[model samples]
Target: MNNHKKEKGDVMVEKGKLVKISYDGYVNEKLFDTTNEELAKKEGIYNPRMIYGPVTIVVGEEMLLPGLDEALLEMEVGEERELVLPPEKAFGKRDPSKVRVVPIKEFQKFNIRPVVGMPVNIDGNVGKVVSINSGRVLVDFNHEFAGKEVKYRLKLEEVVEEPEEIVKELVKMYIPSINTDDLKIKMTKKTVTINLPEVCSFMNNIQTIKMAIANEVIKRLGVDKVSFVETFEKKKEDN
Candidate 1:
């Protein structure tokens, strides 16, 4: 189940359904991000600390970029294609007014040394210092990829529909740190139960987390009541 195998059906992606997708994004033919490590390594941007796998998202949730979100509405499971997005559709065009020059003395007064390409926040605005000259620093507040075209190689892996599977997907979205294998989910006619392992239940502010999960489950899954089950092991007594 770890792999996003193509399901045999004619289901088209729509809003509020749990969706799993694998995609690779590129700018000017250079790989920037991908869900597969082998593809990432092949594209020369692999990071050891990165997690590589299909990402599950609810369509129309705005979890992805604007262009990708719009594209998801027309996608079918197991379909693969390449899409090119213009700057406006992607991250929006860069604004020249967002670029500003500041006096170097202003940074020096705060014990800060401004360097080209260093990130800086000035007057509550965040930007990268793209240049430094005599007595002045130039900052560009536009997004790094602004004005650039992007390409995405996308694959729709699965369209989750079953009640238990949908609950698991929602849990994965809410508590991603918990391993999927460790989650125990059950669905009945009017109720759904989630059993959180000891490792996940005892973390900081667990009651709040459980509350949020319950709310999401009831609101999204239409279950009348949601319950949480926590288990603790007793110490063995030698007879």
Candidate 2:
């Protein structure tokens, strides 16, 4: 369970690897201005929710948040530790300036009518209506979970080194454009080949995308080093 003997400068993870992890964490609900005593008293009411669960991530695939992946890189198999991540490293500090009041007419542009105290989705962003006064509507765009410090109790559970599972996880975690069954993987000593159907033509820059996916998967799954081969038909190329 304890594989903490990771050598310095070794790539902690490689492309197309699968890793399982169990993590539990709490996020402080109050902003920097709020007192710790007050925050503790409001736990579970206004306090940020503490989350714990296990999930498998394919390295270099950007499966989890960037910061969360970074935390896993230094860990070894069955390694468990409590991580105190600051706002900058966590969800980020909430910006008060992001809250603004806009003309009520702007809401209609998106075919949405402003209602007092109702939450509205604005162009993929969600915000609650704080006020409706004299043709103006006030909304706060800051993430509801922003500006809180998060604590994580995490353990690396398992790491899979096979290429086929890695490729399967890659398609599951990053390339949702392709069906898992339709995606193909072939591995040799020197290269890992990936084949996607014509339907997944959007993944044209497979090399670069695979690199990014590998980076994320490594952080989440904990492995190192991989080369990829992606092939698609000539006529189905995306313009």
C-alpha RMSD of each candidate structure in angstroms: 5.1, 10.4
lDDT computed for candidate 2: 0.64
Clashes of each: 0, 16
> What is the C-alpha local distance difference test score of each model?
0.83, 0.64
Q: Could you tell me the lDDT of residue 146 within candidate 2?
A: 74
Candidate 1 local lDDT, 14-116, one digit each (tens): 7877789899999999989899999888878999977678888978888887888877777777777688999987878999999999999989889999988
Q: How displaced is residue 188 in candidate 1, in Å?
A: 2.5
Model 1 root mean square deviation, Cα atoms: 5.1
Tell me how far candidate 2 lies from the true structure as C-alpha RMSD in angstroms.
Answer: 10.4
Instruction: Report lDDT (Cα) of residue 185, candidate 1.
Output: 87
10 residues in a row with least lDDT, candidate 1: 1-10
- lDDT for predicted candidate 1 compared with the true structure: 0.83
Q: Write the per-residue lDDT of candidate 2 for residues 1-239, one digit (tens) a residue.
A: 35456777755654445787765557663333211334434553334442223456755556654566776777666777766787777766888887788888888787878887788777777878888999899998876667866776667777866657765766555664445687666665544556656655555776677777667545544555454444555676688
TM-score, model 2 to reference:
0.55
